[model samples]
Target chain A: MRYIATILLFALKYIALKLAFVPLAVILWLCWITAANYRKLSLAKSDVELDKIDQMLAGIKDKLPMDAKIGFRTNIDPGRRGVLYFKSTLILAPRILENNDRDTILLIEDPHLQPVLDKNYECLERGGNQELNYCLMRRRN
Target chain B: MLFFAMLACVLVLFAGTSLSLTKTCGLSGPLRFPVAFALVLVILSYGYYLGLLFQIQIGILLLSLGLPPILYLAFEKYKSRQLNLSFPKKIGSKNLAVLLAILVLTIRFNKYVYRWGDWDAWAIWNLHAKFLFYPEHWRNIFTASLAETHPDYPLMLPSLIALFWRGLGFVTPLVPVAIAHLVLLAIPVTVYLALKRAMHSFAALLSLLIFCVDTTFIHIGGSQYADTLVAFFVLMTFVLYQETKVSSNRRLVFVLGIVAGSTSWIKNEGMLFFLVFSFSFLCFHFKKPAVIFRYILGALIPFIIVIHFKLKLAPANDLIHGGREKDLLSLISDPNRYWLIIKHFTMTGITDYWIMLLLVMIVLINKMPVIRTLPFMAISLVLVGYILVYLTTPHDLDWHLGASVDRLFHHIYPAAVYLFLLKFSENREIRLWS
Candidate 1:
């Protein structure tokens, strides 16, 4: 009976020691769990968003000088406007973006929406898919 | 051509940093590469400042800077009449599985990486990089109209990205992406090797495992933010701090000072760390004036440059812009701010820094003697400094804490884990190998 009691005491100490590393074990396990999030990731839709910005820029590539500053105004909703604006800034990067200026490039979110061009503006081109509407302007003196 | 250009950049960087490591610090073979990788970018970033100061083209500046290191190596090779460092032309199969896993993750993560990076990356860091990439209107990048992009922030990340852009003669998304990937992988490997050197192999392995599963580390690392690099340097400092405690090689502590100062070049949080670390270091090492002098000597150049940038070039910080005494009194006197800070600290502590906290709790339960170390004191003081900032933050309490507290923790979590695990060695004693 005494011998069995000694074995029980040792088992308790061993179990406690093992329990000390339970957090570390859980940490290692967490990686496998978290890594599963990447499996659902895809490139199809996001790629189109960036490429649309590029496509819009491609139409005005020759007209805009390397160092010119062009204002950008987007009709996209406030919620998604930041996304559209930043993407456009990168696409036309090295060219500073000025909002609400006469020398401007306009991006209309919906294809149906035509940018309202005033007397000072003449359309350079509109080139983008149904997702984006891009327009370059030549100012009319 | 792209591959060759990138290879040339990496080779040039390796040539410079490897020679630097040979003189400044003694690290083992496997350990050398990660530190060298980090030091190269930092050197390039520092060089950017000098380039701007001299009004020289960045590409010319970098090549001239790199030339000296090559010349130094040539002299060394001539002096020794042989080469001691062997360049490995192939990745060994021993670490192939690990390499393959990292490669898979890199490719997978890039698929999700927005071509412009996440909001802060593009709106702030990479956007600033674009200005440097096209310097024709560089003055406009720092104008009040561009205030939302934080022109006051330090230039390490943007400058490093721009350096590559300047070198390659064109900007590509691949430069920043590759950098982010390498930094993510480097952080774990660096601390792992440092720990293993300190005779804590078990703790080192756990760090690798912990980061592998850390969603925040992976995400922020791939996001092109500087927080992970901040984390990387903090851990490196912690490892080196302990090295000075165990070894008679006092020069290691000097290198630690250099690494610590380099952190300030990365971001404002790094500046906070530099201040707290300076105080903690002095308090702990005050017994030896000689050691203090060595540390200060190392930190002096970086510290002066950052001060010049802050005072002369950069705008006032958002948190501390125009306040004299009223802002501090009101922000601190209000008790609700305290409650909000505590609430967020607890919540974020659980969610974001859980792994590090778990290590802390385990060490406490097992009663490890981690409290006496320099890293423990420095990091604790830095945490207090973070809380103090929260008290006086200008932004709304909820918004301020919600947006930043996690990234704040990211800056120090790995080092915190390293500190606790210093005593979590097999014998449960914080013994460092001499």
Candidate 2:
């Protein structure tokens, strides 16, 4: 009886471990297919302009503290502009938004918006060539 | 290095708390790890609550003070087994099965990382983490302008992220990713341990793989939402409740209460599950009143934390705030809402893993035992509660169903599978298959 019990236990353990691999195999295949499709779509949507926006934001991020609030202004087309500013915010994140506030860091991406921003804030820094002009500002008051 | 240091501190607190709790209940070995981990999470969440209410320094102090006695007790327990902390009872084929599950889940989690989680992750959970990371300005998140972000959602996930980032002295997107992967891995680990305790090793491991690989579990678990975490606590509550039935250990009952109550800190749905668990325990075990008291006492530990958060910290939940009578009236009058929920519930289960689910359910029914039906009963009640939420949801019925029905079902799937496997393990006739 003891022998039978021990054998039964060993066999069950072996079977359980082996059977588990079947699901593991299935999951691997599923993940592979999912990753393939995801990578393809992500690669297709990759943007150089968005990368530049993020780069500019990264530079600003190093200068600001964790608690700093950032305001955004951009003339890139409404949809693409939102994407650019969103990518910029992702650099230092959590404190950046499109709102007016005291001691705010204004991120201006177009010269036209600069006139409006210049009324309320002083330019802190300006960068980028003619094709992608931008400025950083602080609230004047 | 900083991340590891902070994680080590949290794990020490978790291990000490869980091991001490297990010893208190006269339980030994690895099973206690998952339960202890869950309890520690609730405690850490409470610590976060303290930080929000008072000074962050005080919260950090409280968190730091919590682990020493618990660790001592755990050390005491381990010394008895010739310093063998390996938990030999937990070893065997189950570990092999668990290992394979981990490998598969690791791959799945990698995919999740590449995609950067789903919408609720970025917009809600991770966004909240950013807020919590700024202790001084965290309250800004609840301002009227941020209402769309659901500021009233429970803070367990964000609090945990903030706790780790504070240790590292900075925030990064990687924080949420690491947290998500840990939680994703935790589900299978917890399930395996809990099932091993409830049933045989083979049955436990088989159920663990099935539970882990379910398409819905894999898909939404990566989304970094509170749902998967909520599911873990819900399942743990059941697993702990099963332990209480086999042993007359009142500590186990108390632990069950803690697990069930901790759910509320995860999501509002967890609060509903806690109530259902309470009501089910009362209805089923009214003759055994101490069981009820023990469970309620355990639950109250976490419940106090939740009360502090809801009353002192969080905004009133938007779903519960206004036009309730009108919504209820409209929901009752419309038969279509009921059908829509039922249809989606059935359809999502079928498409996710219907063949396996149906087979398990049928076998469980055929071999159903009279003992300990309350856990299943509690889950059924919670499902009913979910449906009612849909019926009276302020959002559009179609949109709400489309968005959440599958994820909501995923919440209960693992526990349900665990129950069926427990039944399968218990049935002697089914032993022929092995």
Candidate 3:
């Protein structure tokens, strides 16, 4: 009777030890699934906006001159332009992007800002949401 | 034609002149490939510094650097020395399939999610590389206009990226993107290789799976920050140190030095790592002054480049410049500051390294020893250094913690996992060097 009790206790301990890893494995699986999904889901909203900006910048890559120091100006919230600035800098390389919009030969600014460009200086802006949103622009001067 | 040339140049850069030396130093098997790739990044950055000094053209500079390696591959030596180094067969087909699947999915998801990579990827690291691509305007990278992007940071990661861009004669976003993906892949694979080499197959796979599944690891590594590079060097340096400890060859300590010194060349936090690593290594082998001298001798090249960059080219770091405004004593004295760091670290630990931590506990219960591994001391010291930085930082504690704490953990995680598995190894009397 004593021997049987000892064997039973040992088996129970061994089984419980193995059982502990079962929850951990499950937890890890769930964590991976949730974290991956959560990040993907959370990013789902901004991904579209980023893709639109990417498309806008990429479309104008050839139009920008090499070695030109360009500036990006957008009426799209003072807060949001940081992303636009970074993206524009990357998409258009060797063409420097100064944070300032003044005193640059080329600028990639909002299409709605024609009044600002027209009233402020001698410059041209063309292109948009499709062809000429003017995410790409070069002034030949 | 230049693209093919660039590919050949890259092959030479990673697997070039030092193959015979590395193999002799006991870095055999597939492990040597990733390790060699990392060492190449360090050497490439240092070589770039020399090229810039000499006003060498990028194309000419790369071609000349490739000469030795190209010769090495062409000559009888490389073929004669080539041992069979196929990927680990012990991983088995099914495990290999899972591993490949995980790598592919993580990379694809990262691409879908972080197309341009996380913020610092473009704004800083790749931005620095772009400047280097325009060799004439590369000095403009250090101008005061780009102060916020940390021009003071070391050039290892950026220099590696620029080598490809400069080779191709154009900077594409794909260059940084591709390099980042490779580094991200290398981290888990390094963990797997290290453990598998130790004959702990189960622990090895577990580490790989956890790393692959952990979105934090993927998100940050794929983000193209210098932290990913720093993480790799941190693990690499520890591995080199362990190899130096176990091997009969005293010369391996020199390679360990180069690897440790390369840490500082990766990022500013890496400087802190170099200091801690040196201090920890010194504590372990205090009696062996010859080994220490050999280590510092090996460290000379990368360390000199780092010093020259800091003094000549790079601007003052913002943290040091900003700290003058803050009341440092009060921040240090405050209990809440301590609490904030603890809280953030704990949360990250629970989420990130808890599995490794659990296995560490199991090992402790089963066959506990009083002596901690050298990594234990090094990791603790580095963590303490990070917390100290947090206390003194001029930025809002909450904001700074939110932005940086996860990455700080990520940098330490691979090394920690490696250490945990080393501790968990079946060999009870593992002589981990001091």
**Each prediction's RMSD to truth:** 11.5, 8.3, 11.6
Highest-scoring model, TM-score = 1
Error of 1 at B101 (Å): 6.6
Per-candidate DockQ values are 0.09, 0.10, 0.10
The clash count of every prediction, one per candidate, is 1, 0, 6
Q: Model 1 over residues B1-434: C-alpha lDDT tens digits?
A: 54354446557668757765655565545666766776677777888766765678655675676677777777778888985565443344434434444544454455555555667777777877877776555555665545656889888888888778777787666677666767777777777777777777667777667776777777777777888778888877776677677767677667778788989988899998988898889998899999999899888878888888888778888887766567788789998999999999999989877887777677666666567766777888898989988898877889989988888898998777667665676545433331
Q: Where is the poorest 10-residue window by lDDT in model 3 chain B? A: B83-92
* First chain TM-score for all predictions: 0.58, 0.52, 0.47
- The lDDT values for all models are 0.71, 0.70, 0.71
lDDT tens readout by residue for model 1, A1-141: 999999999876765554444443443454553344333222334454665677667767677776667766666667677677676666666666655564655545566665455677877777777677767765776
TM-score of each: 0.82, 0.78, 0.79
List model 2 lDDT by residue over B1-434, tens digit each: 65565566676676566556656796676777777777777777777766766765734545464557445756676678443333344334446667667777867666655333566775677668778777777776666545556778888888887777776787545566666766777787877877677657887777766755666677788777888888888888888878878876687888888888888888888898888988988999999888889878988888888887788767878767775876688786799888888788778778985844675566655656634578767877888898888888889888989998877777777777777767776775653222
Ranking by TM-score: 1, 3, 2
- lDDT per residue for candidate 3 within B53-151, as digits (tens), equals 578876677788778776765563556775433434343343453455354545554544454467787777887777777666677667665666678
Better lDDT candidate (2, 3): 3
